[model samples]
Target: MRKFNLVFYFSGGGQFACEIEAEDMATAGSIAESLELRLSGCKGYDLYVKKEDK
Candidate 1:
């Protein structure tokens, strides 16, 4: 398993970020997608996932 940093770039001018644990970066991205859909509401946003540095 690995740690990932999830960043959501919202269109409205603010940002949301969090850390999650997943087997790989892809899994982390999937998790981010779910979060984006549910959390972003009607606002547009871009999701980005990066592996956490040791």
Candidate 2:
């Protein structure tokens, strides 16, 4: 399984970012949903995951 970094941004004012190490996109989605917070945008990257493994 592969890991991913999920970044979530909120609409209130500042940024609400979380680095979630998940096996796949589905797991990341579930985790994001559990937050129950209002987010303006979301982005995922594999770069951090690769670097972390190094």
Candidate 3:
């Protein structure tokens, strides 16, 4: 499995924030899903996952 760094930017006005680190996209998606429920009410919450470079 590949490692990835997931970044979630909450729209509004704030610095870039890292959300989670996962083994793969699937895991990252799950993490994001959980976050979405918890973070509900905040506008423009977006999730992004990118593989870590070796």
Candidate 4:
């Protein structure tokens, strides 16, 4: 398993961070997108995942 960091900024000009566990970075991105969709007060957001050396 690997850990990924998702960094994004919402429509209201607020930055947010999310961490997720998955077999790969692609999976982590999917998980982050799902989580983002369910949040309130988020008109839009930039999706991204960062890979770590660990």
State which candidate has the highest TM-score. 1
Question: Lowest summed-lDDT stretch of 10 residues in model 3?
Answer: 40-49
Cα lDDT, model 1, residue 9:
69
Q: What CA RMSD would you report for each candidate?
A: 2.9, 4.9, 3.2, 2.6
Model 4 lDDT tens row, 2-46: 766666666667877777678876777677678778876565444
Q: Give per-residue CA lDDT, model 1, range 1-54, as digits (tens).
A: 777766676666677777788887678778877777887433543444554568
lDDT of 3 by residue, 1-54 (tens): 544454444556543456466776777778766776676354434556554568
TM-scores for all predictions: 0.68, 0.47, 0.49, 0.63
Residue 9 of model 3: what lDDT?
49
* lDDT (C-alpha) at residue 7 in model 1: 66
**Candidate 3 Cα misplacement greater than 4 A, ranges:** 1-16, 51-54
Candidate 4 displacement at residue 39 in angstroms: 1.3
The lDDT for every candidate, in the order shown, is: 0.67, 0.53, 0.58, 0.67
Tens-digit lDDT track for model 2 on 1-54?
Answer: 556555555444445555666787777677667663444343322223424554
Q: Of the candidates numbered 1 and 4, which has the greater TM-score value?
A: 1
Error of 2 at 39 (Å): 9.2
Q: What TM-score does structure 4 among the candidates reach? A: 0.63
Stretch of 10 with least lDDT, candidate 2: 42-51
Give residue 25's error in model 2 in angstroms: 0.4
C-alpha RMSD between model 3 and the true structure: 3.2
